[model samples]
Target: MKDTIKEKVASAVRSVYGIDASDAIEKASFEPPRKKEFGDVATNAAFILAKVLRRPPLEIARQIAEQLSGEKEFTRIEVAGKGFVNFFLSPRFYEELLKKIVETDFYVSDIGKKKKVLIEYVSANPTGPLHVGHGRGAVVGDVLSRVMALTGYKVDKEFYINDAGRQIKLLGLSIYYRIQELAGRNLTLPDDAYMGEYIVEIAKELMLKYPEIVDMEEEKAIELAAEFGKKVLLEEIKKTLERLKVEFDNWFSEKSLYNDGKVEKVLEFLKEKGLIYEKDGALWLKTSQFGDDKDRVVKRSTGEYTYFASDIAYHYDKILRGYDKGIDIWGADHHGYIPRVKAAIEALGESGDWLEVILIQLVKLFKHGEEVKMSKRAGNFVTLDWLMDEVGVDAVRFFFLTKRHDTPLDFDIDLALSEKSENPVYYVQYAHARISSILDKAKEEGIEPSTEHLNLLREEEFELILKCYGLKSTLESVAKKREPHLLPYYLIELASAFHKYYNKNRVVDTDSPELSSARLYLVSGVRKTIRSGLNILNVNAPGRM
Candidate 1:
């Protein structure tokens, strides 16, 4: 619809001023008016073309309006203050929108062709259960993938496991010491050993599984415990993600890179390209040359590669999978690491534009107006599963994605759990349920109102229908900006409009059959919008509270 408006205005501007298409279309921008009375849609075409045409903006706007006098979609086009083109959409257009919503299962728009894009997110180390910090990234990445999919992108959601890093080693050792301590054996634990209580439970399971190897050599014990620990942690991660309703298309392992010689192959490729140099018994990647703060060590003096080297190899593997673009959703702490990763990709002869790193900031949790801090070392951190138990997956996902990914979020548990008016999620859901109730009542009364009768809608009914019509535009904006948070905000506004309309009018008034039919069409449109928004966020919009 917006595209139609832009095209019609472009043609009008070109014909009215006897200008070329390029000159007239270059300055066209379609925006919604702040005040509805001004018009439904407004444009700044005249303001942009005023200088080129050597005419006053108002004069140009008037000329464009005169040319667009009888357009079908628009009721009237007027030159407003300072040459703005204010367009009032015909009521029939919105009525048609309502009819379209009920007639189709999906909204129609030119969502670009499907491009293979890999999204790597929540690649949290498998050293322990996922905490709240990991939850934020999981939610963001999942919703981002969904939104991109809605925009007609072939999205592959993945979890890159850091199963071969030092963290996993520490986890193994943590389990080892815990097992020895439970057996009444004296052992000193490393400072970096995981202190969570789940470590002890894992140790107990390991001890039970490997009774014969309880007194084995340290190396054998570490190896056995690390294997067991990794299995348990992976299971926990799977469970947490399942509870959160986040499903990944793949779970890529860092260890796989080593097992397949991909890491060595990547290093060799860098060396062949003169991007790696041996200096002072260490292999270094000249990342500074590609805009890094300084050169980074790929291989240390001990002849083992750093974590960054493994990461580079893993990313290279993603590119080799034939994806048109790659996206890594990391936490804010890894923000500084983006530059070097991009540099490595550039050095590997790949366009940096193909690699996008979305950094989600921290999420601060609050309960009853008090801050809740979760620390891994303290072993008191709130796991993702705990959050799901506190608030259902719907609320958790919605709250996590209620802001821009780059901005820090404050998740108030009490607010989310509130069934009262303070909870926006509840409010939105209530609106959906209310519409469902109205539809049920209509069916119960045996009133089979056809959507084609929406043409009899009034100004208020059309206003609600217009809101539904803007869904495609809202979704396009969210996808283009990579901001899934906008969906929740828009849903809230939509619910408010519906609730206001419902409170002011009755939908099932038998005397006014025309109004009743129009209201039913509006109800169907609202329900469709709510369902679409919730699906994008991976939430369930229940028909009942």
Candidate 2:
């Protein structure tokens, strides 16, 4: 409906001033007015057309308002301050929209048009459990994927494992030496060894799994320890993510990029393009030529590939996969890494714009207005597991999405657990539950909702309908900006509007059955819209809160 209005305005612009409509197509917007009395939807078409038409802005607005006034879609067309043209939708518009929204196809759009996109996020090293920081990235990536899929994109969720790195080697050694100390052997843990007790737990498991591991040679024991630690930890990570309702279609291993000489193959490709150069004792890529701060090393003098080298190869592999686009969600500390990654992709003969990176900032946890001090498990940070148990899966996901991905977030634990409107997740769920309970009572009273008397709906009912009406546009904005936080913020405002309208108007009235049935249909429409919105965030909208 919004799209049709915008296209009509674009057509009017072309008809009024002989300019091509394409110039104003993207600019023709029909957003809601700030003041309700101003009108329902406001368009700045005259402002956009003033230069092209060579007239005062108000005159141009009046001309376009005259053209649009004859249409039945709007009941009132007013020329607002300066050149703003405000449109109040007609009763028939709301009547038709209310019926369309009851069906399943109202909010879905073909904007994405089936373009394949790969979203990779929460690829934390498998050496430890996922922390609250990882939780933020997980929700952002997962929500963005859902929004994209809603707009007709074929999306793939991926997690790239950094299993072939110095960190994994360090993990193996930590478990190995810890096991030696447990067996009463004389050995000291290296200064740089992992300090988490989880490493000791893995070492014990390895000892029990292989009774002769302690008797084995040092190299074999470390290899066994590495495999055992990564496998166990990876399993726990999967379970934690599942508990949070995150699913990954692909678990890609960094080691796979190194297999079958893939890293060497990328080096050769860069060399052929003359993008690789040697400096001192290392092979470097001319990343500065591609807008990085400086060139980055791909291979050291010891003939070992750097982490950046593995990433370049992995992204090059992504190019071969034939995705229309790719996105990466990384930690706040990785903001500086974006340039080099894009540079690597460009050097591989693809436009750097094909890849998008969203950096998720740090999350600071608070409980009862005090900062959360420690985790229940052995770690310096709060784990995702403890968070899910402390509040819940719904609260954790919703709170993590409360802030923009690039901004620092302060998560209030107490408010999340609250049952009042102070908690956004609860507030939205309560509205849905309230509607469900009303519908249930109506069922008991033998009153079923019918669209038979929709014209009986007044300003407040239409106000709520308009609020529920912006779902399509809000989702499009989210998908384009790659921001999932918009959905949570939007759902809150929508719930508040529904609550205000519900307070003064009785949805189930025994005095007037016809009016009661109409309001019930309106209430049911709001319930379905809220449920669809919450589903995008993987936050359940319960029938009973």
The estimated TM-scores of all candidates read 0.91, 0.93
Best by TM-score: 2
Error of 1 at 379 (Å): 1.5
For candidate 1, lDDT tens digit of each residue in 368-429?
89988764443868788777878888899888877888998999999999997678889888
Q: How does each model score on lDDT?
A: 0.83, 0.88
Residues 508-543 of candidate 2 have per-residue lDDT tens digits of 888888999999999999998899899888999899
Lowest summed lDDT across 10 adjacent residues in model 2 is found at 18-27
Candidate 2 lDDT (Cα, 0 to 1): 0.88
* Regions more than 4 Å wrong, model 2: 10-23, 35-38, 46-68, 78-84
- Error of model 2, residue 139, in angstroms: 0.7
